[model samples]
Target: MNKDSAQTALLWIVAAGFFMQSLDTTIVNTALPSIANSLHVAPLAMQPIIIAYTLTMAMLTPASGWLADRFGTRRVYFVAILIFVLGSICCASAHTLGQLVIARVLQGVGGSMLLPIGRLAVLRSVSGEQYVSALAFISVAGQLGPIAGPTLGGWFVQDMTWHWIFLINVPIGAVGLYAVRRFLPTHGETQAPPFDFVGCGLLSLCMIAFSLSIEAPFSTHRAAWAAGLFVLAVVSALAYIPYARRRRNPLFKLALFSEPNFSVGLIGNLVCRIGSSAVPFLVPLLLQLQLGYSPLHSGLMMLPAALAGTVAKRWIAPLIRRYGYDTFLLVNTLIVGSSIVAFALITRGTPLAIEIAILAVFGAANSMQFAAMNSVTLKDLSHEDAGSGNSLFSMVQMLAIGLGVSIGGGLVNLFSAQWGSAALGFRFSFACVGVITLVSAWIFRQLDVAPAQPKVRAPATHSAGR
Candidate 1:
């Protein structure tokens, strides 16, 4: 093929990888109830399936760039697609929750690499002048994934079976593999620096421990296990400070946190997301199990939120320009938090229009929240620190998603057991997560209040981080 044709084909390959990765993130959510029924487990008990995948992705994401540099992008990208497909097969064949969770971890290993490596490939293959447009083109796939994932997953579960939700990846991945081999440029391996294995391990241990602590309520020795894990998480996090200081090329330097906005934005992102991230997982289950909606209906119900979020993106730059990041994030964070709390008001008797309005408002506000948070976090980093800072931010984003599921799921279980009503449990859970989100507004308040300047768009990495 000609050079132009090859580049176009490469874009298609990368976009497909992104679509597959983003789709998997939300697709299984709609199918969770069905999968739970088939596997003879409670629907809410399936958080581990989601948590395992996201947490594994969080643990492995920092290594993706290094891997792509060490191994050729073409080779690693091809293998990523292969592993994802195989993991999907395993998910489809699983007979138990443990099996499904294990399969998801395998899937996460592949997914962790897809966007980072695919972006790396694009950087190498596409000309710099066209890079922004290239990323914009690929970002459509990322946006479409969340928009399509829930609806598609719901349709599969309702019309066919939950297995199809996973099995569907096989054909797409097959095409991706072929395209990767044929179109993706073979920029052979570069001489990468030695990876900070110790730093990576410490961070990974911290994330794992913290996530498990949230999940410990489900274990036999709940209190003891929770205490121990929380301690371990703290210790691991503390240990990383000294390790990174001593190492020549650590995973992430402490200097990145010296920037006021970066520190504030990073903390706000984690805390706010812990509450907001649970909505996607919790909303579908509430529709299906409590409200008696069909899986497809639940999935379709997510359309207002996703579409509203899309439409709201155009409003972000203008709003932020007028209010600045501090004012915008501060006010928007409350709106987002209140919108989440509003979910508590949803009931079997509530009007459908009101529910749709609530979802739309939350969707719009949440979308703006993500963009502002990301921009403010990385906006002040030096050129030398941008790469590491972005990677660390990406890791936190994934880690928050995992923790959100764990906390959301655990709250439901806790409240349900105490209240003796599943409906009340859902209501209370929503309230608690809303409060968690509300607290993050305080973090955003820490940003320096200055007049808005010309719009500074966040890097294309924001697209993949979503």
Candidate 2:
């Protein structure tokens, strides 16, 4: 193929890889109840299935770039697709929650590699001028996954079974595998650097400890033990900072946070996403368990949010340009947080129009919030630090998603016990998460208003991080 056509094919191949990974993230959210039912577990207890995938991704992400460099990108990409498909099959066949969580971890092992390696491939092949368009094109593909995942999952669960939700990945993954072989160019493997096994272990332990701490209230752990675990988590996480500074080549350089925007944006992204991320998981549960919406209908309700987010992309640049990042993020963060809280207002008697409006507003604002946050975080990175910086950002994003599910689930159970009402529990969880989101505004407010450059769109990498 000619260079242009070949590059186009390469973008699609990477996009397809992204689509598969992205679809799995949301697709499972809608099917959580059904899967829980089939496994004879409580629907509320299904957070591990989601947490396992994200937490594993976060833990393993730092290794992906190194893996691509050690093993050629094409080879690693191919294996990633293969392993993800196999994990999907295992998930479909799972008879217990434990088995499914194990399978998801395996799936995450592959997914953690797919996009980073594929992006690496694109970076090596494409010229600088073409990079923006290429990334934009791939990002649009990533958006399609969120758009399709919930509805497709609901349809699969309703028409067939929850197993199909996983089985669906098989064919897509197989196609991706073949496309990688055919269209993807092979790259020379670089001299392998010494892997930071110690640093990675510390960070992984930190994430697990913190995540389990939030989840402890739901489990049999005592409050004191939970508090202790949280303390341990903080210690382990803090230990990594000092370790990174001492090491010659740490997994992530401590210096990356020196930029004001990077520091503010990363902190803001994590806090903001804790609330936003929980919404997807919570909404399905609210609609199905509380409002008595069918799985298909509940999934369909998500369409407005996805569609509005897509349509709102154009408005982001203009909005940011007019108000600047500081002003835009501060105001939009409130809108996003408020939109989340408004979901508590939805009841059996609530108007459908109001519900859709709430979701749509949150969708648009949240999308803008993400693109702006991502751009600002990476905007100040020097080209040399770009890869590591982006990888670190993506890792934190995944960590936040896992934390969001854990916190949201734990809150629901905590409230359910305290209030003696499941409906009240869901409502309280929404309000609590909304408040958490609002707190992130202070982080955004720290951004300088002068350098308030607008990001037209975020790359597939950041959007995929969502």
Candidate models: Cα lDDT each: 0.89, 0.87
Q: For residues 1-466, could you state the per-residue lDDT of candidate 1 as single tens digits?
A: 9999999999999999989988998899999999999999999989989889988888888898899899889999999999999999999999999999999999999998898898889999899999989988888898898899999999999899999999999999999998888778898999999998999999999999998987897544379889999999999999999888999899999998888888888888999999999999899999998999999999999999989988888888888888788888889999999999999999999999999999999999998888788888887789999889988988888889988898888888888888999899999999999999999999989987575662444433324435
- On residues 234-284, what C-alpha lDDT tens digit does candidate 2 reach at each position? 999899998998999998888888877888888899999999999999999
Where's the lowest-lDDT run of ten residues in candidate 1? 456-465
- Candidate number of the best lDDT: 1
Q: Per-residue lDDT for 434 in model 2?
A: 94
Q: Number of the top candidate by TM-score?
A: 1
lDDT of 2 at 402: 83
